[model samples]
Target chain A: MRAGDEEISVSSTSGSRPTSKDAVINLDHGDPTMYESFWKRMGHRGDITIAGWQGISYFSDVTNLCWFLEPEFDHEIRRLHRLVGNAVADGHFVVVGTGSTQLFQAALYALSPPDTPHPLSVVSAAPYYSSYPAVTDYLRSGLYRWAGDASAFKGNIYIELVCSPNNPDGSIREAVLKSENGTIIHDLAYYWPQYTPITHAEDHDIMLFTVSKTTGHAGSRLGWALVKDKEVAKRMIKFVELNSIGVSKDSQFRAAKILKAISDGYELPNPKNKYKLFDFGHLLMSVRWKRLREAVKVSGIFSLPEFQSSYCTFTGKRTETYPAFAWLKCEKEGVEDCENFLRSHKILSRNGKHFGAARKFVRISMLERDETFELFIERLSSLT
Target chain B: MRAGDEEISVSSTSGSRPTSKDAVINLDHGDPTMYESFWKRMGHRGDITIAGWQGISYFSDVTNLCWFLEPEFDHEIRRLHRLVGNAVADGHFVVVGTGSTQLFQAALYALSPPDTPHPLSVVSAAPYYSSYPAVTDYLRSGLYRWAGDASAFKGNIYIELVCSPNNPDGSIREAVLKSENGTIIHDLAYYWPQYTPITHAEDHDIMLFTVSKTTGHAGSRLGWALVKDKEVAKRMIKFVELNSIGVSKDSQFRAAKILKAISDGYELPNPKNKYKLFDFGHLLMSVRWKRLREAVKVSGIFSLPEFQSSYCTFTGKRTETYPAFAWLKCEKEGVEDCENFLRSHKILSRNGKHFGAARKFVRISMLERDETFELFIERLSSLT
Candidate 1:
């Protein structure tokens, strides 16, 4: 086994932290292990029991256009979105995918015109998610090609990806490059009340969200896309069909159960069974952010992006954004590569170059277990 | 709701078949609902219990190159393969996929040279898997393009797909095209004792297998690739990483449990435990095939492919093949399109044209539930 990965798994699962000099705190990727305790507290409420004979057929509900989607999952998804008031799922067609990663590619495939002479231009902001380019261009698909940052892209017809409360840096985003022929796909993966304020119900033409970021079920690899246009939604479904046949039904079952638990925590009549997921998420994130900010201040080596407080429609309170990642800028005179600087100290962070940003900025995950987070803060505090 | 789809679901679930003319017998898709009874027989032994907190992390075993693969799954996959003697798993890297569908595309990506000036040509023999051309050409990738009918292909360099105990017709196959620079990928999805004779253990450069065909867990959407070359395996893993980040860990967990149960049936010392999956599968398939052949003979309208008995190494007996599908041909003097003729009679089957064959041939699923299969036989028997 990867020794580093073993240490990370151990740190997340158990309360004990290794005192060895080589326990590298892996924050390079967003693993979402921080939510383990919340689910543990949930006990059997979070348990997903699947019978062997159930879900044996490939067909779930064939009456719907998105027939691959389980009815329970569809019901739970719509219920959760309506309860949170983040996005409208009432009139939209829901296409399930392996994950938002697959859905992103599906969105690209759906939006890109197949008969175009040249590949359709795909762009996002400079500090865009690293995967947009990597996933799009890896296959060198003739349907679409990456065209770098959206702000600098000059195109008449293009597919622009708008990741709101964007990755690397949590900033409210909109279509930077607009044209009548241009189409926009909103990656609302991090738009939940815990990550950002649910200011209003988003009414986008095409929106993508995932269970990985929402419920911290990264291993589930489940996601859905909401498309206003029927033709686009059908095309996305075709893409999923052509890509992986369909999403995993077991994951869908588990996701449905988890989502039902979350919704029931808020709306259930039983007073003794109260366990609000968002409240737990919000408080935990706030505490972690506070600790991280203080550690950064004490070290005097790095600076974090400041977020403004806004009134949340769901929580009915004013709160600052607590992004899943920390966009830390290395303020030191010669620290060009912040990722390297952090890696040197046994704290792994993603290089900004990967996100099409300057090397001075590095993205660190704020979602790790307390033991790992505490160790990270301890390591950062002594860096000066 | 799709009325036809709903009816099919009901037929698979309930024992009753609708007498209404509108209830279409959907043998068009291989839903694998026949195995539901086997899993039902398994009872709680087939149950998969997943804690909400467990498998939240993206990392499973980072120590391995195929980092996203769960350790339990890897172990169980090797154990099962060894138990069956279907393919050589030792000294090969195992890469997990959403399904064999995703793994097929990943195999294409791995075989193709990304820097090639022109798209790599992908070819397969006639009556190939219907999805071969559809999935390969859907996106029209510049990395590779579908070049049909490998037997007729004249090329200096190409990638050939070899699906043994082939899809439309159950014929054991080997690569028909060969060249110095050519690559071969084996789709051994149906190379099990139940579907065909286990003549020998398969040891190829690249081999693909799926839970859908093996254990009949179509809804799980889990598959694995055994690759001999390190670089090729790495590329395949990268394609999966880009395609969907990774396969569903919940599905992986369930697959592992199912596989463990399967192996335990054969090798476990407990005499009380006597459920052998292959033995169950072989007997069920044989009875279905026997009934289908008798019905076809009595009707004198349709003809199915004839098979030669072979000595099975696993069973240690001469056994006739029991294919999952029946490639039936219309023997009527005037009928050219068998699919259309079947559709008119409320029996849905896949048109042979989809598999790059003549219109007179139609592929019918033989693995439906007992009620559906009986109805199908009754309809076939009633035909003049």
Candidate 2:
């Protein structure tokens, strides 16, 4: 049950060298590893030292509409939003969650009427985040049911989870189904300057964001939602309270510290500081995306969807899609299952079928550590 | 919006003096404040300092059945179990959760079949934890429904949640329903030596524990369940994965540090260190209970349930009831609602009706800070 045991088992089963086709290298999980060097550069500045008695109270600030939120967390969230200039913070209530995952479920719960004649349909576009359906339908809640593909969905009283800078293909997206009955939850988890251009200060009715994708601190398990409607925010808070009482204050405290550090790095007066989290993150991701595209071009056996460059206010420059994941479509006629093809080459990938896409497509994580990504690129290059 | 604002509001609403009967002091929340001194004594030993890059991996150890767990958390859980000797850790799998609240839901999700003809009945004894029904029926999931009072429940296929040293009224309890179709979840949240006598090592099929009651770290929002069945544990893990992906690693890390400090204090060769967490907690709670009883004795308007002294293996001494909450019954004439009576004096206590008890009774949390609890006692004594 130790982490060492897992490493030993994987190494033993897959062999040490990359020459073995079946050697295991998990590139399927969307863990953000691009910030490792950036954080390492920041050193103890990003470290969180919590006192034993810190946040001992179950309730953080009782007056906060979202009472469970740590005050520091509330401040840091607003500060981060202000720095990013991606999401509007004013006149919005922030509901903290374990992650965007919990927030997604909470949003679904909040949007749907408890006594609806039929379960409200929850639809995201095809090639959506795989967990959307699983999370929505797991309990088979009477409140809501996963109704796939918003583009094709013809329904009233529905929840459309718009994951802009979408998961699988990293496409900049908008709501396809527009109706008063449709509640759009804009999951702006990847709308950070590192991933895509901040078109404008998004003022969606309900918007979701997570530190996991923003700073590659997935294990922190911190996310928040900005809701225009107080009632919706209250319902979302109630859902969290019933689900887990509240998000971890320890996590919230750490997130606040990390977020502050990120903001400080961004606001560093000296341009030569080299520890600008946003700049570091953007550079790292941009390089990774460039290297991946070049590798795909050299391989000639896989293709990626071309992304249009757009001006980003945060960086004040035009940027291309530097997604946390690379959705690859196998160009070879024989490779029906792109996942299996990648698996054969010692690369573990999430099949596009899980994302409600064709079997010819596979999602490879672009968030792996440098050494792992380099090896993946080498192995991918050999496939040609 | 801020903690300072909340403090100001409370002070503004109720003058800062204890002489006034209409001075507010919230004694409704069972936030264990006894451990604050103990943790403060431990100082940096109990403090958690997590590096920026620590726990960046979404998956900690794949070889571990609970993939989301930090190895240190697993180790700390076992160590704490060993130190307490109230719960058996051997031949069990540990599933970390957001809290015992989330774990409670997870256990129900794991126990109930997804394709059952009817939702599995979830039952708890009368005067149970109020959150049970609220959490279970929040979504009105097709998988389970809250069936009140296991004592009256006649159903065969059901999930019974047994909260030992039960909430509201502190009483040692077991499963009231003994059907083979029932799956029992032992919520040993307040089963620590400070609250109750740890007479024997509990070897339930599924047992729950939380730092909230154990270490007074409710804001940490961390809990662990020990399950004897691997399949059940796996299913519970799946539930957590769908619920919030996983518990917070930041909280897990902090819990591990705090638990380690607790264990260290117990295992210390030098008993003169005066930092033993359990001994400190027991002493504080014992003093509080004694003071409360004496105060109530003078007031003569309220009554507390008499608890028998029991031989505790942890302390190797007979211990009286030092429950986290005081279940008080108003003996005053024409006092139909004890909560309302207390609220009239600006002392906030949970109404007994919330716990499915008589309107004459109320639950006052003895776990508040010393100043607040003292103020509550002053208010109660004034009512006489």
As for candidate 2, its interface RMSD to one decimal place is: 3.9
lDDT of 1 by residue, A1-384 (tens): 112211122223222233564577778778788889999998899998888888877777777788789999999999999999999999999999999999999999989887777999999988998778878887788889888899999877999999998997999989897699999999999999889989999999999999989999999999999899999998898788778877899999999999999999999875764478888888989999999899999999899999999999999999889999999999988889998898788878878877889989888888888878888888888886
lDDT of 2 by residue, B1-384 (tens): 112111212112221223444557767667776567667877688887889877776776777888888899899899988888899999999999999999999999999997887899999999888777777887878999988888889868899988989997899999888888788999999999988889999999999999899889998899999999999998898888878878899998888888888887778675586767778778888898888898899899999999999999888999887889999999999899998898787787777777767889988888877777777777666677
| Clashes within 3 Å, all models in order | 4, 0
DockQ of all candidates, in order? 0.55, 0.53
Q: How close is each model in CA RMSD to the real structure? A: 4.2, 4.6
- Which runs in model 1 stand beyond 4 Å of their true positions? A1-22, A270-274, B1-22, B269-274
Instruction: Please report the candidate that would top lDDT against the real structure.
Output: 1
Pairs with backbone N, CA or C atoms under 3 Å apart (clashes), candidate 1: A1-B63, A2-B63, A63-B1, A63-B2
Ten-residue region with minimum lDDT total, candidate 2 chain B:
B1-10
TM-score of 1: 0.95
lDDT score of residue A195 within candidate 2:
83
> Highest DockQ, which number?
1
